[model samples]
Target: MELTKGANAALDAGDVEITVSWRATAGSADLGPSLDVCALRLGADGKVREDADLVFFNAPSSPDGSVRHIGRTPDGAGEVVTVDTTRQPADVASIVVTATIDVVTPHLTFGGLAVSARVADLATGAELARFTPPPLGPEKALVVVELYRRGGSWKIRAVGQGYASGLAGLATDYGVDVSADEDVSAPAAPLAPTAPAAPTAAVPAAAAASAADLPSTGDPRVDMRKRLDLRKKTVQAVLTKQGIPGRQARVALALDASGSMRALYRAGTVARVVERVAAVAATMDDDGTLEVWSYATEPVALPPLRVDFLADWIPLYVRMRKATTGQGGADATLARERAARAAGWPIPNWDAIGGQNEEPKVMALILEHYERLPSPPPTLVLVLTDGGLYRDKQIAELLRRTAKLPIFWQFVGIGRARYGILEKLDTLAGRVVDNAGFFAVDDLDAIDDETLYQRILGEFPAWLRAARAAGIPL
Candidate 1:
């Protein structure tokens, strides 16, 4: 259905890509007048699930392949905030499309710019709707249009609502806590390993082993049934500090799989971190399942992980990392990797996942899959990195954009490489709440589980309170 300014239409839209695009006139050539498209995914109550649902240039897509903003070159014009209605998850009741005057641009408003937008089907490139509202009074951003659910049918609303205070105000209405300044803290000194633990007698790297040779579940839980009274003692002791009792949330790990992380992987440091995270899973997760993902050239999800198999996982993983090429693919070796514990050999997906770290793509892939969930859980993605983050502006924008979500991002740097960008994450501009935190540890093993858990949990409580208060679905 075609829509005029302020008109609402019952749309025949479904599972189609709705591309929102806009460009302003040149009266303000000297001043920045870029058009930014954003998608605000509403929950069942016609409200947002959390900031995670808001996808834009910063966070380009959701975890699931559902909603994504394939638009690039914000000001260059063309399609922006493309929506895949078919991929849109059920919990996301409405997809609000917005176009705002670039926030970073100074002294620019709708009144000074000539802007027009079109919503077209991506496949056909057919214009479904268009809007050219009258000159604005004082607003700097416009809720250009809304695609929502009505009577079991998707409908469209030409919202045309303007936020005089600009993106920040629109963000506030959408549950973003923009009032809070970006949270910043001095980067902690990196943890240093004292001395390598005494080595066991050297054995041929090619030796064979079997699954029976592996250890039992290290978790104190009775086979991962419940989260009550069963976490590891040290994990439980650490969590008892009580700023808040743990609540069920989706937990995920983004382990750096770059070549630089080779040493850590070989040393079994990755396995140890997994164990510590399992202890955390025993607390905050319902079924004790942890979503595991690792990134090198790009991001890839791994099978759900439990604490039991995590033992000797890295060593087994390293064993497959032969000087030869075909030696990879850990999934193929899971049976062997498991048998390799007794028989020691198969590593399938592990060989294909890591390389160069693309932090932006890493986050985009995670957010995409999360949005695909039937009901996205309040998420916590622990990113363990061995070095610096090159795409600062991109990652900074993502953290700022998703700050309203019931998700907290923690970055743990393990190597000597300076985490210069991550250290100042809290100071990035345009953020709602401090959605991300960063800390550096020179050695992964040097930090105790309690200390690791403590550092990870630090800003979590405040984020919970802020997100809930902002009306974001937790």
Candidate 2:
């Protein structure tokens, strides 16, 4: 690429044009022909302009080829000549041009500063096209223009401007500039050096260890199950210590009946974990008031909360888990599960749980219940499933919406699957996520009965303290 500006005393009429050219190169080696070209230009006004072209070149005989002239044309207002390559035996070497100081607008301020600018293409409507103005002060300003291409059209993207207060400033403030009536000249002598030889390839190292070496299962449900059980027991203990009967704190065990739960059956860990948590939550109170609801595509209240409702909710959990495994993939299963969980829940509309995906929908359901349920005791939502969420924006939005709510999001990652997204929600790092103080637990496969029990017991006091700080009536 070559950009040239006619030299004249007058600055305004000085026209600038750029030409881009290319050709194939030949050499002693039997290597294929190659094309050499440059997409940079320097104006007579001490300004720089560069452009990149998606050039299509023919095959070359050798890697090291000779420089050959192709064709040229006048670019900016016919001031710069650009060459085009036709039939060259060797690859085209490069395109070169001189730089010039383009335009300087003084005594003008925008957003609190004086500005001067220029552009490679004069057709642009927006000023400040190639450069930004210098800082306001008693000094001379020098601005540089650089051009390139993006998408379909050409663009002058960067600007380097400076402000100084002495003789250097005078050169910048009123120095030699490009003239208007200057004509296009023959291509200048190529000042840039020839291309160098290509580097040889290096060998790669051996592969690393596989997933078998990892410490835990990647499934989300294992983590969810352990965390839920831990949270329930902790809440019960805290209530017992406060002299508040455990029966008084109503705990609802909402399970996702979505098809994805089926994946857990194949692993065995998810079904067993769910069964244990349900049994524990059901036996928490003597009145047998533990309600189990299953959802998928829609909510189904099971072991109904009506004092008369009694059968094991575990079987239903198992059934749902078996239905989703290895069939429609995890994402599909999770979507079904989210839909069912949302349907089975009380209060909050299904829309709040989101119309798509399990995690966001579960979050929506939690927020809805928190808002609608009458000053209920600090409720613990033990969402048991694989922590596979499909929508990132929805999760962020839900977190923001529920930031003020007194709900703790405990994500239990089950199996040997990865739960990187869930780990991000853990609040131990003092990073208040989405303005919501929620934490998560991962690696359920590693927890023992004693550790699991103690962890659940530990959550009560931490949550209670958080609730107190938030002024939530317990």
Candidate 3:
């Protein structure tokens, strides 16, 4: 359906994609306006509650992960944003999609540019609505379209509202705290989308510092400090009780994103789990950043978790997979496998990684990550899973070989499941010292932070002492 200014269309699809397109040469400059697409997640009061509510190239995903600035269209003339309405919070009454000229690319305006926006169902690739605004004059930013809730259903409207003040004005109108000097450029040099973990290197002996000496977080974002203060306190208490209050380690988190664990992911359990684990990193990591990976058949390296954007990180990555595996079982799965090989999709392959559990592959990836570090600090790897461990021999071999290394594996079983070799990590033979621990919780969300942290760090101190005694470089 084509929509004119002020006209609206009903959105029946659960997941919809918004593509804003314009003529590549529609600007006064050679590169055109250099538009940056963004979304403002607003509360019922029609204002953003926080700065994280603005999704753009810098912060690609909203805090809850309901809305994301996916990327530019292949042609470079358009940008795409995805919205999952079912996952959005009830308080989010609307999501306003806008485009602005990159502040760095000055002297460009929307004068006489032909701009159009389309809304489509992501699953079906069918256009649900389209909007073509009238030619503009001197506007540097525009609210092209908006997805809003009405009578418990979603609807999209063609806004075509012009903002002469660029991004700061549009953001300020929606309640985002924009300062004068902030860089509001679109598509700033983007970080590697694959994973947030930087090249892991061993922390030099001279550089090792206790958790107490580390700052609240390495990221300079001050708001995150206040957000993480309480949880850091809880983690500190647990570390103190475990007799390692000041000890530091490079923290790594591995999450299970298999099909069977979909329930946990959908219920918002995974996000809470990340917060609990992130608190541990905040207190115990040398740099206070949590290196992270998500695995099923293969492990996907994710962006390292920072206390600064902790609320937004979980949803952005955790829900990266599709909502369902396949409707037709084996045949459908096989067809997708073939299609994936031919399509060469740029994003992470959700279907391949969501099919089954494969621990050794991810374990190797994590192991190689830390081993590459020159003189690494003692590493604490927290592995979260909810399924069975059928590859007993492979897992045991990997653990036995790494026993002498300054690495400890803490296998946390999330739900009731058969954990074959994990239950016997304490008894595994041929290791220089006990380098692993296993614990299970039937209800992860129900567990308090203090107890969870205590149980998680229960065996780490013992392993640290033994590793030091065995002549391993501390």
Candidate 4:
């Protein structure tokens, strides 16, 4: 049935999926479309069930298992949030769903946003109802719809309510800690939408007491997907500009697991990088799984991480604090075991390898894997680190040779450490092609996925053409 403003309907469907979609053109030049799905649990009085019951991006799901916020759609196309009617907590008498303007134009109001929402039954996937709110009054936020328990039945209401105060005001109505992001900037960029707290040594304490307080709308995978989609044309355009056609390729990640980088791992920067890489791999690789390795001395191939398992990737390994550091070096054996339990994703076991910040081994393994494939696919390797690698000359020599292989290296500098050789790689001479590139960010958390992925991929197309012209096997 069509839903009009302030109209309500009894939703007899047992389990339902609600998707919100909109077509918005910003009135301000600096403004971008940044909207969010917030699920507010309410008690009998209809205020709020409790502070912890507020579900959005950071806290993706309600603890009671009733609500699940699937990642956002790209460029404000839309979003999906699921509700299992029977699973809602006993105390949650109502679930108020709101769409809020996160950080767009200062004057953006719900009335200006052409928005619509639809509810569908999960089991049969049948459309239960849909509502397209007209130009709302002057509110930055809108109470689009609400599902509540009424006389032993479930019902959906098209409230068309708008919040003048936007998300901040809506959040304040709930009990989320409304303060500042506490991320102890690593002498780096201000990482927002990710975390709070200073660089502490202990993982558990920081993640619990401070890090979780930071506001975040999307996870690493969702962030990466949106970026890749937005920049698909740009990436294609560049390749065309250089007369370089793109290819389907495998993706890998080389992580720096050294002592100095301990604080970053604890801070969850590395994990976020991995998830984004996995998302990129899903787009590039034949399979969505990515080869993950750690090197301080030598490279240890860890379990290949699939995008599906990325959510649990960090939380699962939080106990393995400093796992990549020189303290234990690299151990694919342990990483593989953990990955094996990833609920049956097609992840390969990592090979056990150990050494001290040895970058060459990572190069060797990536090349070897490509060599072994019946007909190798082109490959891109993302090297995540806070500083430069050892064996500089050997790595340079290796890159010179691999310039003839179907492999390209992108090094991301995570902290303010002098990248002795990495900074100079673009101009280094005597290669079949320029196969290596480098960019630095004080913190990955602060960088938007679009900006980060674009830069990460910027020079790759040129290198691909060079490698192809050099007669590297396709």
Candidate 5:
């Protein structure tokens, strides 16, 4: 169906690919505008919930994996965004397909380009709708079309909305943190490791035997099965399935305490995560204790938690604790400082270490902590975050350094915010052995234990063999 501006068409239940094509105007400048096609997954509020909701060149796929920018068309005339309505999150009400010109010259606009977009059923390869926007004026960006939820079904609309401001302006209107775009760079090739490549293929049974059967370090009275909660037991099973059964490792938990994570903390989701990861410690750690830290601008070392003390851990450390401060001036500051020190807390005036994302600082601290130990065990650091990671280069360097050590960083993205560097760990290079893995879950409370465990340990076992082969102590 050829759709005019404002026209609509019903969509079937399946993956629909939106292709946007643009060409330079006749007899224009030799250099054409750098056209970038993007898809914005909007919520019921008509705005994106987070920066991850916008799928573009930088962020190729949505966190839910429903919306994906499939790159330039086969002929290289346009870009395609595949919308899997079948997997679309309930909160996503619509996906707006937009096209923008990377302005290299002053006052560049859509008038200099001829742009059109089409939607087709990905399965059958049948064109469902096509839209040719009217001639635009000074707008540098245009919302060519939209695939939106209609009751139980889906529908497509040709929304020829123009934006005089460029991609940043248009994105800002949709609730994306455009400020992050400035610090963000296009996904680059991962750094090459200086060391020799370790055996990455699944290790033979005999080779894995030496590293198997971790010593039982916990109390002899408490049964292992009885110690772990159901969810943690599932984690243990997953570890076994991944070929690292009964392997001992020091476990650490790093929780995000940024402003954006306030909701998760308030809903007791963060506490639940602590409970779950503590199980990993129970199963793997020497002392059956989990080292804990909460971070935003800085990392706050909290009291270490054990399976037995988990019941009281959340209420005391995980839960937010507010204390009076500015109202009483110097006396208040002195009082709070003394009180915080007496309680063994890190800082005097603390708000869960809540502020902006300074991942490198906390990461450095974690690295230093383990480095100080005489002989640290193979450590599994589970960094739970809700996205907003911008220090990509620093993080890459740190991971590279960590590759030579016995530490494995398993970064779990808690929500659908832009994960930036964490989302691109697979492509990261310059490591003796790949020491990091990442996966995002939309809702922690809703995910089944089996699937969560599987994802958590997906790359760990392989890393274990590889690490040992590289002569890293485990």
Candidate 6:
């Protein structure tokens, strides 16, 4: 088989022709089948250009099949032809073609089972042609082949054959030649090459020192602050871009109610946390959903407490405070022990219910509940915890599995504890960390009402920006 091209000279917008030639052996035996041939025009960057086209030809079954016409060039300067046949004939076969085209980077591609023995001018790594030959025995066969261009050569990149023997010594035979006019303009030179030299030695040191003094790169705190600021800006941009006003930003709040939550309760911080969280939730206007939950082993839905409903909940809140105070110094540990002993649960149940416990079952429940909940208006989950014990790996895996779900997790550490786990949720500092998609506030006690409000308000925008960056829909 021989492949040739028309005059290789053309403008960047000109057309070209490609031709393939082959000979079939004279015989009454079945030559099998033929395949399609495709041509791809590429830009200088090696990406697919606008000028690419494809042509297909069927190999002849009888000696008369040897004279098959593949395709034609209407107005283009060039044409590509393919001789797709399974049986190798003893006679010489040749293809001829022309095209009226200009391609900055030109390449060829073929698909089928036939073995390609040679190619020219085309880089060995380039995808120029493809073909698939029929199977040997009675079993039906299908073959897929594609060629790609490398630095200076064309190479067969992919081949799929079912019930067919692999083509042997296939790469040694193919070639390609790109003929273009010399008049085509070359790409502009890089600016840096012609630019003047930068400052040297003493001057450079001074500039470097100035840049160094401006900011440090490795500081996590500073980095976090920048990331938070950028997140807020991005969120605002998305809201504006989506034409959703700040007041109209429909927000849903889901809080964690596992046993670990009792830590915040015992620290005399749950009420304050709820107060602050509620206050933030109220700012979303009447359009927002403020469904709350107090989950222990399971999630128990709290009424959608509106700002107006806060007055009514105040009595309930007072009763809750009195109930806790009634227990005297009974903290989360004491409460867990009481619950465990009352149920005659295993001793390990106390540890499991404590802040350091891992509750895979509870987490699964939360995930299921979240899945079932009426897609709650671009919701955000605010988990107030002391960074207690939880199935980190299981939770991380679950989160990854459901990553496509649009729920933003913002953890607020409500007590004095090492929030190392929470820090992993911050994307910037935890850049390579697996769970960096979430956010956290580690020092809730140090935050004032204004700061708390700002933090809460800030979360929506930050999360919205993150979701957008991740290509998640609102």
Best lDDT among the predictions, by candidate number: 3
Each model's TM-score, in the order given? 0.48, 0.36, 0.52, 0.46, 0.48, 0.37
**Model 3, 118-233: lDDT tens per residue?**
89999999999999876566678888998877657888877776766677767766778889686443211011121122333445545533322223322322223333565687
> What stretches of model 1 exceed 4 Å from their correct place?
1-231, 312-351
Model 6 Cα lDDT, one tens digit per residue, 194-291: 12224333334344322112233332223222333333344344445444545333344444444445545556456545544554454443222345
lDDT of each: 0.62, 0.35, 0.75, 0.64, 0.72, 0.36
Candidate 3 global TM-score: 0.52
lDDT for each residue of candidate 5 in 1-474, tens digit (9 for 90 to 100): 897655567886489888999877786673545678899999965699888888998899988788899998776669989999989888888889998876555556776777888788999889988988766656777888988776477888776767666676677667777676442221111111112223244545454322112223232211222324455567778888888887778899887777777667766688667766777786777556789877788788766665543543444456333332122233444454454344333442355465787788788899999999999989988898889888999999999988999999999998888889887898898889889999998998787557766887788889989999999988
- Between candidates 4 and 6, name the one with more favorable lDDT: 4
**Candidate 4 residue-wise lDDT at 450:** 54
Q: Identify the runs in model 6 with alpha carbons over 4 angstroms from their true place.
A: 1-268, 314-322, 325-366, 373-376, 418-420, 427-446, 457-459, 469-471
lDDT of 4: 0.64
Model 4 residue 340 lDDT? 34
Locate the minimum summed-lDDT window of 10 residues in model 5: 185-194
TM-score of the candidate numbered 1?
0.48
lDDT of 4 by residue, 344-366 (tens): 32332222333246677777876
Worst 10 residues of 2 by lDDT: 5-14
Off by over 4 Å in 5: 1-227, 320-349, 352-354
**Model 2 alpha-carbon drift over 4 Å, by segment:** 1-248, 254-261, 266-268, 279-288, 291-311, 321-357, 427-446
Highest TM-score against the true fold, candidate = 3
